[model samples]
Target: MTADPKSSPLFSFGVPALFVWLWSTGFIGAKYGLPYAEPFTLLLIRMLLTLVLLGVLARLLKARWPGWRGAGHLAVTGLLVHGCYLGGVYYAIQGGMPSGIISLIVGLQPLVTSAVAIMVLNEKVSVRQWLGLVLGLVGVCLVLLEKFGLNDTSGGFPAWTLIWAALSLGGISLGTVYQKRRGTGADLVSGTIIQYMAAASFFAVGAFAFETREVEWALPLVLSMAWLVFGVSIGAILLLMWLIRRGAASQVASLFYLVPPVTALEAFILFDERLGLLAMAGGCLSIAGVAMVVMRPPPVNKQ
Candidate 1:
């Protein structure tokens, strides 16, 4: 008997939605952790723990190791995905850019990814998908408009901070496409172990160069590190790699459009941030666009 595709451990049901929610929480975890440590230092700790955990998991699972060339590619992709992306984000937040503004800037990533995928990966996007991308971006703006209001009162962000955030947008977008093109054959656990190790090295260098490498080890900081390392760097990232390998890059990137709204809702519940009706409507619009982009049409039949 043929097995159901959704039943596969990699493509299990609700994985996409689960990924978005978990990924969004990384920002929250950062907010929690950053108070007790510098950006590079905090990330160095998370990356090191993630590397050790993934390495052990890879060994126990007897996961296949990539060949030398594939290992190189995985490391490069990790530099972009984990190193550049998180480095940019953490540095920006530390530099005093409001998370709301940074998120808004990062919201441009789907459109950027779609264009890059067409050029780099030769992935053709349907007009409907393009429309969906636009609608999703608009919805993100609507949802985040109130947050921007907070930013205005928060004072001006340094130009370099914006640059770092923009680099993060580029990092994740290209990293996804890079993995789809280059890292497809590697087993998840082994590949992820290498990725985290490389990312840890990157952050360690940054910490030594820029930070005091001090951590308070407070309860919230330790808990935040654990959540980010295990919950985000492992679980959400594995799901992301699986999705990118199986889906069109454009389609996969479109899912990021939903992240801001989801993160906003998470903020509401966790931090008691206000959730307005306008934001709800915008969230609905963003979800509608995601559905349009990801839900494939039924296959045509010839008589």
Candidate 2:
């Protein structure tokens, strides 16, 4: 009999690695696409495209739809996760907050998620996990310290933009805990479609109210949009939902700490960006911290 691929070590490692890689590309995609469209407009388009694709997939797979109560939970998650989180991110970037600063701000997610999970889900976090969370934050700060400049106006973004970043941090943190608490066990495809529908509605309202809704239709924008819709939205999000279903919320949130480091490496390879020694060390620390947080303790031997 064939072994279940999902039970293999490779599958376990590969899924998280793939998720981090895909999630990191979102920063690149936002940078690429934002020049051609306002944040809301760009996100609205992406969400609509994602919804269409997921809708088709759900139909083909005969995916089950959750009851209204379960769907309401999914919609709340969608608003918090996709709507507020992505909206804040894209808005901050569009308003000229450097992606590094934004990433650093949101990198606090694991800690925030742990706290929320404790209060909301009644999840117990050991002292080791708390240390790991702190270590991860320190590592992310080290990775991004070079990007900070007191004298640079580019670094001195408007106070409102910083609020957006804060909102984003809160959004994703709460959303992660909320998903673990209430959004699990639904059909992944159908649940995501509902989530995207909520997020799309959010973007539609924002786009109509705030943006001119003009799109330049350039090659970079087109490619970035395609990648965000297919790669990040569909692929990474499904993986995230699956991960959240299968793990402790705090452990799952720790995966986000790897994003900035992975994003730095991606920038280096794709854009000739240089990584300093501190950044490399920070990456190592982040990896170690995540390992500490996510690694299961060895089973105790019976006497």
> Which candidate achieves the best lDDT against the true structure?
2
Q: How close is candidate 2 to the true structure, as a TM-score?
A: 0.96
lDDT tens digits, residues 86-202, model 1?
Answer: 999999999998888888788888899889999998988888888899889888988888755753644577888978998899999899889989998999888888887788889
C-alpha lDDT of all candidate models, in order: 0.88, 0.92
Q: Residue 200's C-alpha lDDT in candidate 1? A: 85
Clash pairs, model 1 backbone: none
Rate residue 215 of model 2 by lDDT.
Answer: 95
Per-model TM-score, in order, reads 0.95, 0.96
lDDT value for model 2: 0.92
In model 2, the Cα lDDT at residue 276 comes to: 84
**Residue pairs of candidate 2 with colliding backbone atoms:** none
Off by over 4 Å in 1: 1-13, 150-155
Clashes of 2: 0
Candidate 1: lDDT of 126?
A: 86
